[model samples]
Target chain A: MKKTLAAIALASAMMAFGLPAQAAEPIDPIEPVEVKNPALVELGKMLFFEPRLSRSGFISCNSCHNLATGGVDNLVTSIGDRWAQGPINSPTVLNSFGQIAQFWDGRAKTLAEQAAGPIANPLEMASTHEMAVKVISSIPGYGEYFKKAFGDSKVDIQRITDAMAEFERTLVTPNARFDKWLKGDKDALTAQELKGYNLFKSSGCTICHNGAQVGGQSFQKMGLVRPYQTTNTAEGVKAVSGRDQDRMSFKTPMLRNVELTYPYFHDGAVWTLEEAVAIMGDVQLGRRYMKEELADISAFLKTLTGDQPKIEYPVLPPSGPETPKFNPWAPAAK
Target chain B: MKKTLAAIALASAMMAFGLPAQAAEPIDPIEPVEVKNPALVELGKMLFFEPRLSRSGFISCNSCHNLATGGVDNLVTSIGDRWAQGPINSPTVLNSFGQIAQFWDGRAKTLAEQAAGPIANPLEMASTHEMAVKVISSIPGYGEYFKKAFGDSKVDIQRITDAMAEFERTLVTPNARFDKWLKGDKDALTAQELKGYNLFKSSGCTICHNGAQVGGQSFQKMGLVRPYQTTNTAEGVKAVSGRDQDRMSFKTPMLRNVELTYPYFHDGAVWTLEEAVAIMGDVQLGRRYMKEELADISAFLKTLTGDQPKIEYPVLPPSGPETPKFNPWAPAAK
Candidate 1:
């Protein structure tokens, strides 16, 4: 029994710490997200860009996770309803489906649940689920599309979130230059990038940032070796789990498009890759990165940029008479 | 001498009030806006969609004059910075280049001049030209695009507005069903729509509304036959011309995509096309439209819906370290 328990612990550790050190592959290239329903995807695309979902009739999911700028809005944190500051950085929605769970704390297990987070957040879309359903129902063109996407004649929040997830599933960015290198194309990576990859492997970044998404596979402490001081009060899993053991631990974010997803990390305090790498070396891995190492690593990051999806703007339906008037700035009347 | 004077006065009146009694070709179809420079148009597209030009870095020309929704936000008036109400309804940007002059009051003589209006207006973008220029110059990606568009290394408001105008020049939507009819497609209009067209022509609606854009060729009194009731405080061209005669006189709006550009007229008080057509009959001409006549006119207007421009949303450059943090929600420092 003692020998069997020992074998089980070792197996679990190997899976948790990634494949054995000398294993052939360390990280895998991200694959494109599968879209089974094109009609559902189309409806989701319109809903994703529909600003009328917000109480302000202006903010949308695209406002934060903007696909035009590498599926991230490229802000330290997102500005939301009534100009409210977001609690944390907006992650790239490009390969979000590959994440073990959604959100920094892994609170939501699926993209559908994650999407519903912003729609009703007072600081975000500032709209209730009920209002969102009502508003969409009022728009004449949206009703038929919803019915076509889902068999439901009456639109609901569950259908709205599911369609949004279905559309986002198709937003995966494939064929980055680094991905080409990962598939055994020797000429794909520059000398600096290869050197950076070597340093990254030896210095232990791949321990957390591995697999298809290059990091979103598991949860780990943000500052294991040293405390990371930031004004951002997000305690990560502690807020969700209500346990001291889970404090300061967050779901590792994907780094496929790290070049464009700047202002790195959960706190979003660092602006450049060089600075972020240096801080990560000190706080997470307990290694001091030299200036040359930072430069090489940043060069490697740039190669991750893929072809941004060229989306033709959807011609939104004209507002119906029953639609609520845009009045975010007006004083609430008694 | 008396006969000659009488002939001269009659000719002047005919020219001012459109072709007299037996006017041929009363209301021509709108022509497409000409594009001279590809590079300038590309840069202008980025600038037109650049929300960073606004004080809040959230609203762009596309916010109000949305390409995704028939060039109009479809609101009674625009909601500006901090939710301030706009003084008038936003005009359609599509086919607007065909207007005799820009704005309802003919305040800006050219599209380039008109482009500069909203950037500085407190109720609009709420950003001064100096700040706009400074912000654009600060972004490294925008600086290079400007240089590529215009051979100037140093960016300024004039060059910015000029490039934007060049881009707006390409926004014309041609080939409406009405335009096809104009080009001698005899079967273009349905029986009801054709009757509405005949009524529109024979009922003196074309007296001021004659031209390529259907109405943008001249200024006309809002209520020539009866006093028009609207709570909107816009004094029309009188505010610009400082002439009592110009009071309640506005440059007639184009009707190319009237179906999508709803809540008709300058005040934008009316919602349904039927009611708007009825109001025009009572106020513009000394006649009242029957319910069926209003329905027919509304149906005919829907035929004016043109092929909308398919625009790929531009991938905006990431903000530099020097870029201002989005903090409209934060309290001003004491």
Candidate 2:
């Protein structure tokens, strides 16, 4: 009863101040992930770095969504199998479990589902599920890891994706200055950052960019007010939804660690943070910001840079004679 | 005086037993490297994983000499700049600092000198030293690291290579079963492994494969007795010396973690350790090994598998505007 009264009082006070009804409440602090099953995590980490999961035996999960550099390859678009160029910018895997769905189009509803897509993707890993399983099963050392991770030594695609997702769940980056500010540390952000936050709220940027993951709560049109020009031919959610209205709509990417994830936008057309901010304002909100305002907004965004996940590079098991040889020049398996 | 007397007594015993002059002393235990300057190592680690040193900004030193799986890519030959296939297998970087010289050709006398070759190789990183320097210099975070590592803020190729070489020097793989046996641990090797070691020494294999690194002391002809056959056009040491006798001669790769570093030999034609042992017996020793002998030699080689280097995946700094943009499609800059 006391908590309910306090909540009501806070809401009334927020209303009185003419602030957004959920002002200071939309953003939430991300907590560090705690692994329940260390064995599973250990196995998953090995799998994540295991290049045998790909047909080329060169690319791994870490190849594109690298944990070392903000969980991304830091490329405009990832270089894929046999140096094939990726069609879109690879999203950061950090804190992705908190998102409502996976991928820019939100095609896969879960992280595990997303994990399976790359292995078979013609331009990416260029591997069939059967071949991946065959390769893993052939390795004698992996059998022990599988037995430890799961109840048995079954090397199935489902188990593979599950373990990978479990490992990715631990990749949450916590303790950014913005997260500190959100957790009620008043001095965490600077005066300029505070002013920028106020401007960001007033300008209505948070309508789509809200909740725990900042922007992952909702899907929004790339150009709400104006057309966003790009050389990329990607049709956003329309490819998944097959709806004309969803043509330019995409899942609003999370703003956490936006500073480290460079070459912004789905097309990765923008390089600098300030430039991305300016373009977002002009295209999405149909507004122009002054240089000082841009600087403040950019400074505020920089505060989102969080403590990156500390990962011990796993020593992958050696391949046995049964393991299939990598065909670097081979086309994607049907 | 006591240690000298014991050594003399042991030498006399070996001579009495009709053992070779060096006998049990041929292979020495590898010692774990103790890092003195952590700051330099830290900086070098960042550079080692820094793809910005490549023209495409996708390949780092770890791409070919990966630390995760025995410090070698495990490919028959490395896939380099624009997916260009390498002419020879990449040697393991582990225990490489202990080598007489770097590369299969023993061209570069120091690890630092060898470090510069890949950055400029058109078929490899495809990056000029100037461009690499420019890119690294533009990143503000690297400046602080360089200052911390060298006691100055200068970002020269010399300091860069020096830092990288220092880091590579720490990549020694110690504490193998063979090392334990060498350190007087009687129970370290199994009966089969001990038998295999005896056969390995008696077959004259220790003539070239000896020392703490188990091979890296000198350059030897690939096929000492019989001619080796391979489609690979690499002329081995002849590429460096330009002498007829040095044509098929190459550096003896250190077999510290031979178990993990698979696809053995210069051309990486043989996949299995047993096969490699058989081929070596036929070509180098002028004798064909029986199946049991091959198995024994292979088992002995597996004892060389050491503790792999434990490394924390480093988080590289974000690229600045001043940093040159990566040209994934561009050819080697003239």
Candidate 3:
């Protein structure tokens, strides 16, 4: 007990300052989030999967961030309204509540604000917020759902986004093998995985990539020690803040469920985790990892998958005769 | 007892002939189908909702025929691959197994045949069978699901379609109020609905519209009495038989959940059930009903909405590194 306590103290001291040894990982690890609003969550789940909210009426939020396929579209970028290509890779919604802000550019601070942007974006859902609200109000079933969720059937865009955020909060993954190991389960990780964890800490990869999500908590330049070349057009943080110096700087993406969300980075150019790890080492730390080290790091990263959201598929209510129908190729209503 | 026996014998004799009486309706109410293969059914459920089978990797079978909103997309016509407008409105997948054949033109003889058409159709999923099979084979997790479903993980398009058909069989909607009424529960339908049913029988509507599905047993010329005029260009049965004389001839669509699967008819021009009923009267029978009669028929159609399939959303497995990444806007690979 005394030795373990000393080790923990030393690890804490190491994490506080810029000191490195084979120290304990500074990651807090994820815990199962409590669903604070059940009614709101239910409404949100429907809205999340509700394609009727879009102009196409066929492209729901679930179209891009599918729950079955790891809360992501699994595309390099999403296919959007009228088959328009999204500007950048869509970040996973699995642990998005933990994200400091929404979107790659951080244009929207709250989930509600972020939610509103997509509906009006001509390249995204391609429906004005007013039209979306008008369509929802026309559906009689949604009125009752709204009333049950928010005390009144008077529908608005704010309630829609709020309900979506409520459900998103419960989507935080928990009980990963590493989290189990962190909680003192000795057999939770294999020998190589433990070795990988130690190496990850000692090699300074944990400096920017730490905390509950192991990376989402901070912003860093895409290429710190070395420059990265890519065909992706995104200028990252500069698009939001309009700061020339902020170019190439992006929010460190969360590593949770990284195994499921493939084709890594903002461009989603990298296919394998080993390649991503090696690239980060060379570009972020100016260190080239040996082949074996890359393999070990990959083994450690696999343990972060955790539990996926397991709720039953909600049976959506049928539409009314008066409800505006989805006609994808139809000319937009003026 | 003798009097009752005489009435039944007389009714049977009349049914055998072309004589129409309020004697007995030929409509056989639908029964709940028993699910035979539970494991295969489970696998089929996943495939039915799997979007990866599409070229865009976003449009799944559910995108057009959504289970959440009555097995049909309720669009005037479906939206398909890369925003292509579908040739016709999607049929209700609910209780489609009861149909004699699949598709509006009855080109595919079975559901499996129908299932395969959309995957490769340039207007639909726009993916070749070979590429789809390759993608599924690359995913290691699907191997287990396939093994459990077919006793082999050898992923093939045949297995994919078979699994989807198996799941679709379980989508049968039973326990409608009309079914109860047919089973001698006098109180199952309201007085107005009963009046509407009687009117429907008194008219020749019951001639083509009989049996378990209320209409899927035979094909008839669409504009029998009066030439139905519309802007839509579907030659119906002629497209298959290549017979010009078979123009506008179509299989009578099942009336089950007709309330949910609107806009009605091959053109999907009519929106309301009342409007459809009125059109059928004028075009098919050359008889326009009174306002009260239209209201009663509308009430009767509402009872066709049976207990919908209550199911949970399935969680699909992650992709392997070898799986082809979806990037529609990306420059074509050499």
**What fraction of the correct interface contacts does each predicted structure contain?**
0.52, 0.69, 0.77
| Docking level of model 2 | medium
Q: Write the per-residue lDDT of candidate 1 for residues A259-291, one digit (tens) a residue.
A: 878778998888888999999889999988879
Query: Judged by TM-score relative to the true structure, which candidate is superior, 1 or 3?
Result: 3
- Write one digit per residue (lDDT tens) for candidate 1, span B35-146: 6678789888888888788877667898889887789877788878766788998999887877889998989988899999999998898888998888888877787787
Best by DockQ: 2
lDDT of 3 by residue, A52-127 (tens): 8888887778888888877888888888899898888778888888777788767678777777887888888998
Task: State the lDDT of candidate 2 residue by residue for B54-115, as single tens digits.
Answer: 98988999998999889998888888888888878989999898889999998999999999
lDDT of each: 0.80, 0.85, 0.81
Off by over 4 Å in 1: A1-25, A151-154, A330-334, B1-25, B31-34, B151-154, B330-334
Q: Which lDDT tens digits does candidate 2 get at residues A1-334?
A: 2332454466458768876533456677788788998888888888888888887889999998888778887788989888989999999999999898999999999998999999999789988899889999999988888888897899999989889999999998889998887765778989788666666656677787777777887888999899999999889899998999999898999988888888789988888888988989899999887787788778888888889989999998898989887757655445
Give the Å error, residue A103, model 1: 2.3
Model 2 chain B: weakest 10-residue lDDT segment is B1-10
Residue-wise lDDT of candidate 3 within B1-334, one digit each (tens)? 2332454466558757955442265777777778787878888888888888888787788887888878887778888877888888788888888788888888888788889989998788888899889988988888988998888899888898888888888887788898887776767988778777767766667787788788877778888899999887989989999999989988889988888788889888888888899989888999888787788778988888888887677777877878887766645335
- Chain B TM-score for all candidates, comma-separated: 0.90, 0.92, 0.91
